[model samples]
Target: EKSIILLPRQNLEICSRRSSRPLPDPRPASLPPSSRPVERRRPPSSPPHLRSIRPSTRPRPPPRKSRRRKNSATFRRSPFSVPRYRPFRACPRTTSRRCTRNGDSREKSSEIFTPSCVIDFVFRWGAFVLTSRLAPSPPVPRQGMPGLGRGAKGTVYVVTDPSEMLKVLHNEGTHPTGAIQYQWPTKRWLKDVRSHLGGGDAPGEDHGFWGDGPKWKRMRTFLQTDLLTPRIAKGYLPGMIRAAEYASKGAPAYAEPGRFHIFSSRASFDMFSSVMFGEFSRMANPGPETSERDRMFCDHALDAAEYLFPMMSNPRELFWSAVGVRTEMYDSFSNGWKNAREIAMEKSYAFMDRASEDRLEGDFQRRSYLANALRRQAEGDAVTREELAEMGFLILSASLDTTSALVNWLVLHLALSPSTQRTLRKELTAAMRDRGAETLVPEMYQQVRTLPYLHAVLRESHRCTPAIPINVIKKNKASALEIHGETIPQNSSILLDSYSVGWDPEFVPQPERFRPERWMDDAVEGRKGTLRQVLDHKMYQKPFSQGARQCPASRVANFEVLTMISQLVLDWDIALSEESEKSVRSFQDVPYYQGTTVQPVMPGFSFTARS
Candidate 1:
């Protein structure tokens, strides 16, 4: 028989007797059968010498307890040996909550570790899923059922109220505009383009539209004061007018039934190209002498524009991009950007080569915006080829997409409304006659720009269909925004719903009707003559937005659109085809804006040369 005794520090000792009896199992019966210790018996027949020996029964010395030194850094698990607490507070957006460990409430004196703080950090920067797993905070208080809603991404507060929107827009500090380039595929695609152009990892603070802060401010000031002002925009009008006339050569092809682009897309490309890149302008105006290389380059540029459209329009592209998933659409955008950049760079090098030799001269050559810029570079301006590439890409992209889309809408609207067209043409004819200009000229820009009817038409068209549907701005992280008696959390994105604002009944009376008279001062309520009275037009028409984040090229866009429309009206009697008219009617049925901008998916149109 054996007796098991527990010694000091939980050590075990066995004292055995030379007998057949077995000691009871030392392990607890509560343990599973599989986990219990097995029993063993001694042999029945023992050797004579072994049988003669008896087990020692004398008490043994106690087992010594294991001890740690007083100054030891090693951790010992005990009820009193609680973890030393480091300060961890919850996110300010969240409320304080009781924390427990192993079903025991944490002591009030001891600091509790809150996982929310870490989760919030990850959520803000890394956009991790851990934050989503946490219990949601109390809903933000709203005022009288405001149209405030959340974005698909995170912490995005979409503001639809006009009054609140105006406040958000003007308060640039509270709602600073940013985050366009950060969206999935756009960010990736831009990076690739920048890399190809030899631009640093990020776009130049001044040249890029997506950036915010001092660099952006300085750039914006320079652009507004020096480059994109009305005066500067007017100076480029001659070149733009010429480009429009050049693009008019291809009107017949676009006029064909079932043609998708109509003519505005190609026309815009030519207008901007001639003004931006002197040599590149020829590609848009292809001829018998036009080379295969130029045609390929033009195709690539158009391809890139086509590919980029979906990324802006489809919100799902952002999700797929975030997950690093490659869809067919993503591949197309990527390849298009790559091919465009490569070909454009080839043309840029050739242009630079010519510029270096001072071989470029003449009124038409001087019209290139790049030529002067290249000259500045040669004279020790801090300009790089990469910057030049970036500027070209920016100009081209803006012209081909945003400007082209605007042109399409303006032209389509004019064609549908023959009365509006006739009134506009009469106004144009009278203005031209006053200046004794047989055709629209750059010098007549000031008069044309101030034309009340023209301005009213542009404003009315924009009101009906805003170019950018939703403009994104973010609230400062350190401050919460209070709008319409509701609290919007800091770090929330304020999506200015320009489209909805345009259609708001409170801001616009009869928002459904296409009434240019609302913008006009005298119209018989709509019958304003040359000597017209100005109206109290308080409509919030910020198509290009307001303040520092406003589109820098707004003036340029207006001038180009006005010039093209004026020239087209004078030279061609544009008529919408049956299919196009049907498309326009259907479009009117649903007044919702589509894509990043308002892209018109019309059937086609016919252009008749006016005799």
Candidate 2:
């Protein structure tokens, strides 16, 4: 038996199954010459599968020479043919086969193999999943929704959800790591400089601010127990009041009218110097002939420390420094460190001498941070002179900038919100009147702290304009951190966006509006509740951060700011100068910048003594 299959548009031909003879060319008589198909015979030994019991006599059409000239209408009109541009659709009938174009082949089959449909489906869905997992999140507007993002440093997990943030921090086991500490940039730069100068590259044990492990613990404990405790912090009240009195006296003659930050900075330095080093800084006092030179040098040093970290961290600045294009910045940084170190050393020596004499005379009343450290040293503690100097510098740097910035921001907020300022003054007046005090005195420090409205304003200010916008980078070491439903890998850098959480509507209703009332118990009505209730709802306010590694001077900072604000509001009426108002208005228009902190850049304001 023999069989033959008729291909589409092919000419019909015949051959005997038992004979190997070639079949005659069988062109159909009715077909045109150009449309006729060529004919060929199958071998006698052809496979049985290729053989057919019967052969069709119809002739097949000629092969397509070029598809470019073919009528596209035919394929478009045919239900079996797919358009080249459109995605391939699955055929309705699985058994149906049609002569369809398959790349360059012209063939007939029982089923068409179209994997493009599956590929198209997977590509579209797979891309979305991958992008969501890997890509950085979008920018958050002032009043926009919050989400995760990425930066040059590492992954930035921005959680606007207070509860979620609390969970992450709460579970951040002891020794929670934060973004590279501010000190690292300068430290690394200095280390490189030392290495280039033929110093060994071997790492030394970190001490003071940047130290971790045992050293960090010891330093933190010493600070908490001996210096920053509430009692110890309160002990600085007399010094703080003196600084405030000096600031009030010199408020009128400061370099600029509304630039009260100058006074705040000087006052903070004076208070910190007196409390920590047992010497008063005459920085805020007016002089006839450069009497404030040392104070100015101290200010320059602190400013240098601030700009040094940023300059070192900035690649462009580093590049410029390397090529000697901008040597001024490098010189400025070097001078700043040198001046600060010299000052720290001088103060350390003075304290050591005073402490030794005090110990000989049995005079424990002159106790100061330096004196206490000296006492520890005398008791055979391992504290070094270099360590003491470093700690002093760190304390001055931390206290001056942070407290000055906070006081500046708080006063700015009050100046902008006059009604809020009036309310605060009223509260202060009532408290003072109740105590029959005409002026804020050392004894009234405790009373001023208890003023609910004043404290609320401070809390609200800290929340809205966190001194450190994103808490220092926190690192998880033990296991992967789970936030929301996503699992952050182990040892990943965690950045809690305090700015985002501070403005989140869930924790703070009308977050954009500056309303101290939101924090008052009497103001908690309608949909919004009291500040305590809100804090209870999600303990989200972490201005000083929450952990063992939290800022050690937080209580002292609070006391300093509270005392300054009380004195200023009690004795002076503040309002933004015209230039200051314009600057503040512009700040409102575009409120944020990505940097070490995210707080309002306020304008200067004039202060008038209250009659």
Q: Candidate 2 — worst ten consecutive residues by lDDT sum?
A: 1-10
Candidate 1's C-alpha runs over 4 A off are: 1-153, 160-163, 169-176, 192-210, 213-226, 257-262, 279-285, 289-295, 307-320, 323-325, 375-382, 447-449, 471-474, 504-510, 523-539, 578-596
Q: Candidate 2 residues 1-611, lDDT tens each?
A: 00000001100122211222222222224323322222223223221212342443456456455443232111222111111112111111222222222222232233322122212211211110001111123321111011112333224343444455555666556555433343433444445434211122236645333445455556556656666567777777777666676666665555253245566677777677666765556576655532354575556665564444335333455456546464544566666666765666676666677667754222222666677677776777655666666666666765766677677678767777778888988987877787787766555666434588987888777666555544434556667766656777675554444343344344455454567776665554443543324453323444566566667776667777887888778777777776545434421321221112322333456778888
Candidate 2: which stretches are off by over 4 Å?
1-153, 166-174, 178-182, 189-209, 255-258, 287-293, 317-331, 359-365, 441-449, 504-510, 523-539, 579-604
Q: How many backbone clashes does candidate 2 have?
A: 14
Q: What C-alpha lDDT, on a 0 to 100 scale, does residue 128 get in candidate 2?
A: 6
- The local lDDT score (0 to 100) that residue 219 gets in candidate 1 is 36
Root-mean-square deviation (CA) per prediction: 26.5, 27.1
Which pairs clash (backbone N, Cα, C closer than 3 Å) in model 1?
521-535, 523-526, 523-527, 524-527
Candidate 1 weakest lDDT stretch, 10 residues? 1-10
